[model samples]
Target: MALNNNRYSCPYICPSTHMQGEETKQQETAKIAVKPENILSAPYVPGNVRPRSPKVYPPGAPPKYLPQPTESTSGDILWMSPVGPWAAGHIDWSPQAGITGVRPVVDKYSITRYSTGEWRKNNQFTLTPRATDKAKALEAETQKDVANTFSNLDKKLNHSNEMLNDRIKELSYWKKQVQSTLNGITEELAAIEADRQRLKGACKILMLPEAISRECLELRTGRYEPDLVRDDAEQELIKEVAIVGEIRKIFNDTLIKAELQIEMIKSTKAAIERDWSDKEISLKIDNLNYTLTPDSNLILAHPGVTRWPENATTLEYWKHYCAESIRNCEDVRKMSAKLRADLMTSITKGGEDMKNQANRTNSALAETIDATEQMCEKLEDNLKDNLQKIADIENLIDYLKESLRNVQERNKCVMTRLHNRNYERPSVENCRDEAQYALMAEAKFIKESSESLQSKLREAESVRSELMKYRGELEKDIACKRKSLNIDKDRCARVRAHMPTPEEFAAG
Candidate 1:
């Protein structure tokens, strides 16, 4: 519709406009003029309402200017949309439109055309290609990441398998070492046991020799006095007794050593067995682990299986433990062997010593016996000589007695003659006559002879008594010597002969 210029006027004029009325009117005319280059033109339409000027207010009040719409400038009218298409349909700015009234005709084509163009420009040409490229790049990068992940996982799995295999081999090796040590310990234990038995046997054998030596000493005590001497045989017997005792003690000590060694070997064996047992279990576990795969039925999610054990040992410690155990076993075995050797040596040496001592004792006894026999023979000879001397002294005493008897008979005859002369010749004959003197001299000689004979007889009888006493002593000494010989040669020698052989002692 065309708008009339005279329909509305300015309510108030500027002072400059009044002062230059023609210029103002020209400017107003210019303001409403339309260029002919405008493309679309709307036809003018007549309205019943008369036009009027804009109202003016008092001073300081606002003055309102109303520009009249004109039909000639209708082509210059441009519809400026202030809202979106959806909202445009709900508004009507025409004077004939009411507050509640919406526009009867909607321009849906323009909005539809604009929307189609935006879809073609932004969606198809710009955003779609950019999004496609981004998706392709993301897919490629994801595929590469997946390939790297798979490769790393495969490498890790292979490394784990190799480690498991190595562990299995290590377990196998240690197991074998432990088994070998166990065997050595077992053998050592057996040897030690045997040694113990031998020691006990040796101890038993020593008893026989010790008892025999004591018994021989006891038997020698029965000797009679003067022949009961601590002879060579006795001394050797004492030595043999002492040696047997010492050998018994050695056997006992050796037995103790064997027992102790046996105990040590047993302990070592137990430790090796335990180590072997652990290795066996570990071997089985490692083998099972090696056999497992992703498809294995035994595979399960063992929670916390990756955690390390509290008592886990390092490889160095493990190797050291095995080596130390084997070394200990070797040491124990060596000790056992040494003990056995020493025991054998002791037994052999002991038996030889005892036998040698017994032989010595036997030799001494034999010498003592020979010496006793000689002594007894000498005593018997001395006894015979003493008896002979006693007999000769008795004969001398008898001879002296006969001489005394003769002297007594002569003295008696002389005294008878002297008595007859003294009576017949009286005093003169007693004074110094030749016949009287001769008779007195004869009497004196007879008295002297008788006194000498009595003295001889007494001396001879005392000599005979001494010789007889000497003969008795010699007889007693010979009997005592004979008794000692019998005791030593018969009783003690027989007892010593029963002494065990060196082989028997060693065997025990």
Candidate 2:
């Protein structure tokens, strides 16, 4: 076969083929027959340009170009890198291509050691399968554990959610109960407060009747002399003042009780309201907890939050506490109702009593005024009759005086006639005569008549003086009665008219 001179040539040809003559032929045959370890250098070639063959070809098979190597080595080509895509960019490997009987460089030694270590590690026959199987089993176990963990988390979350829902429901129930109690207590407090106000109003109203009673008593003090005596009207007025005072005291006491009761009711209401407020907040908190989820943005890590409170109450204690609060509210409500009822009773009775006493006082005043007016009228009539008797006595005394004067003149004329007769008839006339005897008897009779007339005049004048003194007393007494009537009937009665009605007192 002819050798072609090309630098890019097949590296399968031996270098001894370049010799001439029989020696050349002999070298060629020797080279061809060379053992694997005795082969020399070969040239580099690319994998795609020159495909490799597994076995060597004998001489005279085909003509081909071959590369002349610049150097040679004495070694068999134990192995060559196969030409393929994997061998691209690698140093072309041919027969007898490696270093021959020389120590490798440090980098080559390092590469060889590294490659040997990799091979040895890959060829761990005993440990690889077992270890691989264990790793695979671990992977499977990890996957299963993860799946189980997820499942458990889901179950636990569901359970916790259900518990939160139940808790929320419980809170809601208690909230409703607390709210009801709060409402009841609130209403009771309002009623008690209103009753207290009414009591205050009633007390204020009582002042009017009390003032009237006191005023009436004061007016009675203005009565004159005999009228100032404690008559039925005066006695009734005094009693009215006492009664009004007593009623006022009772109202004040009732008002104090009402105020105290109102405060108690208000306190109870406040407690119930506080309980209700707590329940409302708890309900909201529980509802929020029930609504929460692991994915919720509101969720956060609260360390140690799951711990139970040391002061937490048990179910029985909780129920008892709730029930006790409601019971307390109910008790307070009942108390408020009873208090209001009692207040109502007090108002009614007090009002009626006040009105009745006022009426009695008014009636007594009216009767006393009528009696005074009648007494005044009778006194005036007696004064008129006494005056008429005084005038008739004065006329009778004048007539007695005139008659006594005429008798005196007649006695004087008789005496003068007797004296003239005695002087004119001397001793004969002085002798015991019928004219002298008649004159003497006439004088004696005149003297006795004058004395009797004078006695009658003195008796008449004494009687007239007594009657005039009695008339003056009567007139004075009548004036006093009139004054008393004016004070009682006119002034005090007008003040009594201002008394509040029973309905007004009750309303108060």
Candidate 3:
């Protein structure tokens, strides 16, 4: 019988038909084969061989055995036979085995099949459909986070823009205020310059050197001269000459008038004495004749008639009688007494009238003297006051002259300065023209500057308005962006809840 290598084998030995007739011989061969080396050399040993363990075999089945094959002498079978289904059924598969030939074919087929089965199992149990959905969800959350961050950045940019606009507005407003203030200062400066020019003109008009000179001359020449003394002296001389001549003429006239009156009275007294003397002599002669005649006739004397001497003249008798009568004269005494009384009365009355006239003259003279004295006193007082005033005025004039000299010196300096400035005499007309031109230029400059300032102020105001408008728009944009950012933040919060946590990523 031919043996098939696929057939299973047991651990028991059986006698071969070919080996039965040779059994006695085989027994001796077996006994010799039983030796240690011989047994080790046997392809299969009998009882000394260890069978395949039951753990590797099925229960109640024979253990499979494999023989070590020898090399064929002929080159007919070059490739080795594979360990078959027994090994396939009993041994665990190792991916490390480099299978070849039929074993490789079987191994590849089994490995393909197992891999397909494992892939199907993993698809079912290890990796679920929810994983793809989770990936998509995570991608969406990342997109949302990106969008929210971008939106927040946009809002920040908008807020920065708004703040810049506000700053620009404030700057523009301040620029306008500064421009206005500058314009006001410029106008004030112009007004001050105009006032200064006016004051300069007024000073020029009022305090001119020529006017001061004329005034000084008038004061010095006209006001404080001693006019009263010369005038009074001239008047007094005229009056004294006239009054003294009049007084001398009156004295001479009065002396002549008194002399004529005294001479007339004396002539009249001489005539009266001469007439009395002539009458007394004729009366004595008549008396002598009458005594002679009467005494002779009376010789035969009556007893009652007184006796006279024979040589007694009538004149002597009469003379004696007259002398006796004159001695006892009461009539002449009463007449004399009456005349003396009249003369005394006339003289006393006349003297009293004269005395009253003299007294009035004296009083008039006293009044004149007092008036003259008072006038002199007043004049002296006036002269003294005038002299003091003149002295003061002279001092003032001296000071003024010194001042004028100083002023002249200063003017000379000024003139020298002007000359240096001009290099020649500057004509009044030319100076006036230059001044007017300068004033016109200044006025024009002021006007133009004012206009420029106004224009600048207007421009500043316009810029301020534009800046304010920009600020307002920026504020609105900031508000809108902020609102959008707030909405994005809310959406980002919602997205964050489903996304992977930072701690989960770390763990993963």
Q: Count the backbone clashes (under 3 Å) in each candidate.
A: 3, 2, 4
Higher-scoring candidate on lDDT, 1 or 3: 1
Stretches of model 3 off by over 4 angstroms after superposition: 1-328, 417-508
Cα lDDT for residue 213, model 1? 90
* Model 3 poorest 10 in a row by lDDT: 67-76
Could you tell me the lDDT of residue 169 within candidate 3?
A: 54
What's the TM-score of every candidate structure? 0.46, 0.54, 0.22
lDDT of 2 by residue, 1-508 (tens): 2333434333333233343254344435545554343222334443424334454546554222221221122112222233332221223322213222222222322422112212333344333444588898999999999999999999998998989888888888888888878877887777777777777888888888878878878877877767778888878878887887888888788888888887788778788888888888888888888878778999877898888999888999988988998998898889879888988888889889888888888888889888888898999999889989889988988888898889878878877776776676676547767877898888789889989999999998998899889988998898899888778877887888889887887777
**Top candidate by lDDT:** 2
Query: Which stretches of candidate 2 lie above 4 Å from their native place?
Result: 1-162, 293-296, 380-475
Give the better candidate number (1 or 2) by TM-score: 2
Q: Write the per-residue lDDT of candidate 1 for residues 210-271, one digit (tens) a residue.
A: 88899988988888878778888889999998998888888888778778878888887888
Candidate 3 on 1-508: residue-level lDDT in tens?
2222322321123223453355445435434433322122224446654544432223453222221112111111212123433123212322112321122225424532122222333344443445588899999999999999989987876676566555455434434443443343344334333333332332232223223223322222331222112332233333433433443343344334434433433343344334334444544443433344323653354585577868666756744643443332323333333433443343333334333433343344344344445544554555455455545544554554455455556556555554554555456534645645555555455455555555655555555555555555544544443333332223322332233222221121
Clashing pairs in 2: 36-76, 37-76
Question: Which regions of candidate 1 fall more than 4 Å away from where they truly are?
Answer: 1-165, 248-260, 287-303, 372-486
Q: In model 3, which residue pairs have backbone atoms overlapping below 3 Å?
A: 287-314, 287-315, 288-314, 288-315
Model 2 root-mean-square deviation: 19.7
Candidate number with the higher lDDT (1 or 2): 2
Q: Which scores greater on TM-score, model 1 or model 3?
A: 1
Better of 2 and 3 by lDDT: 2
